[model samples]
Target: MSKLAVGLMSGTSLDGIDAALVSIDEDKKMTLIDFETLPIDHEMKAKLKDAMDIGASSNELLCSLNFELGYLFSQAVKLVCEKSHTKLSQLDFIASHGQTIFHIPDGKFKSTMQLGEPAVIAYETGVPVVSNFRSMDMAAGGQGAPLVPYFDYVNYLSDETICLLNIGGISNVTIIPKNASIDDLVAFDTGPGNMIINGLMEAFYDLPYDKDGQIAALGQVNLELLEELLSDEYIHRSPPKSTGREKYGGFFVEDLIKKSKLPKEDLIATLTKFTALAIVCNIKAFGVSKIIANGGGVYNKTLMKYISESFDGQVEIGEYPDAKEAMAFALLGYETLHKRTSNVPSATGARKHVIQGSITYPS
Candidate 1:
């Protein structure tokens, strides 16, 4: 019998929650039974973005969001269950990529926080929940950011060389060779995906996102600004490196804006193009035969079209058209439930392949 698993993901965009109900067999084959993205309203989005770098003045505010987001996550899970016509008790576990507040990969503050409390999800859903997937990797001297490679390998295990690129708030690529060995895999953040693009929309346009990338497509890409963005050392950095809104944040965009001195629309267009270029550069660096794009960024038509042009058929746009990250997390949750190691030591630079995440049983 196939096991039913729920995977909940809140991306770097803080746009909303993506919940997927996946049925998996012993051999790791997956069938997506149900999937949905519940958009967080303007208030939640504002609160989350504000809390990213700035220190919060109120403990009550932070604590409230912690529980509220948990409820929000549970509701998302409930909605997916209803749509799939599956009950909570029938499911095995929930794998949650919790909301990330801060990701400090280096120094004394070496922990990344994803804070939709798993205990709260367990209490609300009455299902054993597995979450906090990143910290363990960080403890083991890994980036603790790109957790999708395990799932990427499981679904797209191939004989030829391939790269799985996930474009969320940050863009990360995972490399797989002809004969898959754990050590052969390479993955890292290419650069900004939807983070800069969406940040601009919210800052100037007062919108949450660029809706199919229409706003960006209408404007012209400023080559000067694009070149300036590409000049960052992060773009040229070698593999096993990961970045987030921490580096490519509002401040970074403001610098681009100052240098460009152009209309807001033109600035957005430039940043969008910059995102596409960073992705293409990474794909070329990997030298893989096929590049498979996935995540929220794939929904942006303009981004996809530019990516298609940038690669010029050298790399295909998307391997999975819909919610590959969420689907992959579902597979990760399945692996975690079965007591298997779901992390790639090479990808995260972890010393060993230890099982990630802590399980919260319904009590």
Candidate 2:
């Protein structure tokens, strides 16, 4: 049987919501039917940014944004279905990755929180929704991150060591060794992706992103700053690790600006190179055969050029590059519905595989 489902993702970039509708067959093959990205408005983006700050917002505001984001996600689903000419009644289920506000992969608590309310989506769309996909893996003694490795395993398994590099707000790579099974995979975040670059753009250029990295292309990279950034401890960390806004957020950007004496454009150019270098350094250490890049960062020409130049092997863009994460969530939902475990225990550091999300039925 073929099941039609929609996946919604709000990544660490805080840029927008990506919704993708895909058809999955009994054999677990996915065909993306349609997709859309609903950019976050300036006000909402600011609100989300504020919420991400520690001690910046109250519990009440955080509580309200949870449902507010849920409502916004419902609107995204409705608009995507309208544009795709698909009705809610025709869908099997909706899978939402929600908006991640905080992720603490290591600590005494070791918890992660993603805020959009799944019940609101279920109620508004009149469809079953599967969400909060990370907690189960965390409970099973895992990092509860880089969940898309399972998706990569299913779709990109091959006879060569291939790295699926996703550069969203935070960059993570999934390494699939030759003739790799799920247990043979290794994955982890490779420090800041567009997080720092986008932060610099908003602060100095007053833009959302560097846009094809045009700003970076206009300036020279400050080699001194590049070397300084490369020395960050996160870049040297081994696998089975993850990081987010807590490490590379606004405060980090402010600190970087204070430490650098270079011009704005030069600083951005350096940061763009930093992103590329961080990814390349990790890939080389892992001895990856080829790199298949995806996510919003792939669109930044300068960043892509830096990555391609630094990497000696083949570098290619993923199919449906922008919609990869959204589609992954949809595939997770499909797997959950079938009572299948969707998490890669090796990638997430889980003791065992388990169904990853909580299902919410329509009222």
Candidate 3:
């Protein structure tokens, strides 16, 4: 039997809430039924940014954003259903990645917080909700991130080694070697994806992003700046890792803005190379045969150019770039509903593989 489900994802980019309606067969095969991204307004993004600054916002404000985002997530759910002429009653479950406000994956009191209350989603949609996907892994002494590896492994397991790279707010890669089992998976964050680049773009040109890498094409990459950035320890850090806005947020870019004297375009170009190099540096050790790229960064020609240059012809974009994460969450939700473990122990450095996500049911 094939069951219908919805996956909701709101990335660090503060771009929007992505909703994917997916159908999962009894055999665990998935088909994306309909997908949509409902843009978050600037006001909401500003509030999210404020809340992200740990302890900056009042507890009440943080609580409000959670419910507000849940409402927005539910709206996205409803939008996708309407697009596909489906009904809320027809959904088996809704899996939400929620909005990651703060994450401290290492240290004595390791913690991660993804807002957008699942209870609100259940209340509004009258459906089962699977959320807090990272907690269980964290409890098992894992970083509780880069959870997409399970999705990559199930979908693209192949005879030859291949890398599935997603460049969203943060960039990450999942490598599945030849004839791999779940234990053979290798994945980690490759440092900044579009975060630093997009932050610079928004700060300089008042644009959300440099569309198609047009601005960067006109400028030169400052080698000095690139080299200075290459020294970032996180990018070169070994696997069983993950990162987010805490390391590459607006403040990170603001510090750069205060220090750099290069022209805006040149700085953007240099940072784009930095993003590409970070990814390349991390993946080179694996010797994968191919890289299947996805997420928002795939549309940036200059970023792609740098990545493609190193891999030669080994780089290619995956299907439905924007929808992949949401689709993955839908599958994760499916697995959780079936009491299956979806987090890869190797990828997360978990003490053991555990079925992730907390389930919420409608009253």
Off by over 4 Å in 1: 55-58, 312-320
Q: Compared to the true structure, candidate 2 yields what TM-score?
A: 0.99
Model 3 residue-pair collision total: 0
118 in model 1: Cα distance from truth in Å? Answer: 1.2
Question: Between 1 and 2, whose TM-score is larger?
Answer: 2
Clashes of each: 0, 0, 0
List where candidate 3 sits over 4 angstroms from the true fold: none
Model 3: lDDT to the true structure: 0.92
- Between prediction 1 and prediction 3, which has the larger TM-score? 3
Q: Can you give the TM-score per candidate against the true fold?
A: 0.94, 0.99, 0.98
**Where does candidate 3 clash, by residue pair?**
none
Tens-digit per-residue lDDT, 170-258, candidate 3: 99999899889999998889999999888988898889999999988889999998999999989878888999999999789999999
Q: Could you tell me the lDDT of residue 170 within candidate 2?
A: 95
lDDT per residue for candidate 2 within 151-233, as digits (tens), equals 99999998889999999999999999989888999999999999999999998978999999999999899898899899999
lDDT of 1 at 170: 90
lDDT digits (tens) for residues 1-363 of candidate 1: 688888899988788799988888988888888888888988887777667756542566667778788988999999999987899998888989889877887676577877787888999889999888887788788778688888877777788888888888898888888778767788888999899898788778878778898998888898876787799999998877888877888777676656667888788888888898898888686557777888888888888788878874455556454567777777877777778887887877778787788889989
Q: What is the lDDT of residue 280 in candidate 2?
A: 95
